[model samples]
Target: MTTMTRAELGALGEQLAVDHLTGQGWAILARNWRCRYGELDVIATDPGTRTVVFVEVKTRSGDGFGGLAYAVPPEKVRRLRRLAGAWLVGQQSHWDEVRLDVIGVRIGRCRIPEITHLQGVG
Candidate 1:
């Protein structure tokens, strides 16, 4: 069996996040949303709160790099906010809430299924 590459691992993490969110009844507005400024891993709407979520997914192979959650810095949060504003402007939706969530995933050989969702992270 071929081992997955780093890119593949990241893709898996994003898919897992999307699935997790979907299970919670959030409709995916977009994925891998990109512009010259930055990229958002997942964008979804939760009917429960009627809020638009801008999610950033970070995946790591192990404890290295201080795990996935450590990857999100203040600057990245700012970038996400900016991109979300652009997305909102383009869609022309009057969102009641704008939430920034982070999904941190740790991939390992034993497949522990590490996932942590931090809502309103930014």
Candidate 2:
């Protein structure tokens, strides 16, 4: 099997993350949202909790990187938090709560992508 390019892998990972979240009843608000601060991979609302979630998606192949979880370091989480706040400020809608989530995807040659979702991270 041919190896997937990094961009392709990332797109696939994000799609997987979105699929997983939606399957769990989350409504997707945005994807690849960008601002001067940074970009949010996915933004969604959890009907059950009436919360708005900002998601960070990290994609990796094999173990070249530390791991999927390691992709989101403390600094990255901090940045995501700031971006989330900025995103909220631009919107007129209000949510009961704001939450952060990280989704990691691991793809191997010809294998199904492995997805891990870490909710309420930041």
lDDT of 2 by residue, 1-122 (tens): 67778898899889999998999999999999999988999999987997999989888877687755677889999999999998899898999999988888877764677888888887
**TM-score of every prediction relative to native:** 0.90, 0.91
Cα lDDT of model 1 by residue, 24-103, tens digit = 88999999988988788899997798799998998766777874556888888888999999889899677889999998
Model 2 ranges off by over 4 Å: none
RMSD for each model, in Å, please?
1.5, 1.5
Per-residue lDDT for 71 in model 2? 77
Pairing residues by index, what is the TM-score of model 2? 0.91
How many clashes show up per model? 0, 0
The CA lDDT of each predicted structure is: 0.86, 0.88
Q: Which stretches of candidate 1 lie over 4 Å from their true place?
A: 67-69
